[model samples]
Target: NSTKPVIYPFNPNFITDYKGYKLGMSVEELDKLFAFRKENKYVNSAKEFQTVTGVSDSLLNAISPYFKFPDWVNQPKKQYTSYSNNKFENKKPIVKVDINLATQEDLIKVYGIGPALSERILKQKESLGGFVSMEQMQFIWGLSPEVVENLNKHFIVTAEPKISKVDINNASVKELAKFPYFNYSIAKEIVTHRSMNGEIKNIEDLTKIKGLPSEKIKIIALYLEF
Candidate 1:
């Protein structure tokens, strides 16, 4: 006659493949738990374990009683509150810096920016003379909307850089392509339109040019003169 295997208290975080089989956990559930553990995360509670492994309620009830978590996991987290008796506490106000004047050090201080990204931002700013608006930051590759939002919190385009505006009416396709917003194709289209019609005057005139980016007409307008 075969004797029964002894059941003992265990940490679910350290459950091995063989041990998981004995606990009646499916292969997929065990794989999920292992994958979660590979990320260096631990399930501190039975509910969390079920969440990670997708275990049934009955199995969770049967196994959870035997789950032995560390003492710290069971303790309530402490909260500290600050109370000041001084009425004349001086707090320094946060000052937003001009993006045109921001250094590499300043750009990297924002949460999502690293060395490579900071360098790219500086290069783009240098190429464009300097950023004219916060909206221009959206064009920087690899910057997520959240990162851009964070950048807006710390930087603003207060000091406009001195940029020589291009004459759209007189500029060649190559000359027009030099602008940050225009590509070779769009530049060629502008030149073709100017040749076919009279000189392109304003944003409304640009809308008539086929293959021109309608959305960027406003931004492109900033760097162009009639």
Candidate 2:
């Protein structure tokens, strides 16, 4: 027999038969989930999970609270936004956020950023200590331009991290590569250039390294000092 579930969040896609049973899912529902998995498909939301599993509303309400989805699936969208201006067209302005200081909990309040996306944004921020510029938001994987624009509506980069840079003149290739922006290959190239030429003077110096992404010079520049 399956024991009752303690209150905690879990990915609904990972639900096994025992987990389903304990969560009060019918055999039919479990079968549907199993079949869906065998076909390599997914259920994105609580509403969709109910539709697929044919569960009662009561069961769905109880189980849905724990249905964690992959970041892409649960990102809220604006499909129903009315072009016709109504009461909402002239509502009070939202309080703006300094994104550098905002926590995971604060990010979740944004329409598109659910728990998963919030963590992703925070994780990326933590890697760089904090954002040096709002433009760096583009580097975060899976954040759509529309979603980014929505974030910009309320959030701004009001603070900058005191980023301690890898001194290419003295640091090893492994040390330089530890920055998310630099790969081992590029890190090695930077070190080689430093050995043959001298200390990398500026962003222009980094561009001379092959395999260093041409597009990333601006963002990469932020994480380095002399």
Whole-model lDDT per candidate = 0.82, 0.77
- Residue-level lDDT of model 2, residues 108-214, one tens digit each, is 76656778888989988887777887776666775655567778887897767777776766879888888887889988898889888888888888889888877
* Deviation of model 2 at 153, angstroms: 1.4
What TM-score fits each model?
0.58, 0.61
Q: Which model scores highest in lDDT?
A: 1
- Candidate 2 lDDT score at position 175: 88
* TM-score result, candidate 1: 0.58
Residue 132's lDDT within candidate 2 is 80
lDDT of 2: 0.77
Q: What RMSD value applies to candidate 1?
A: 12.8
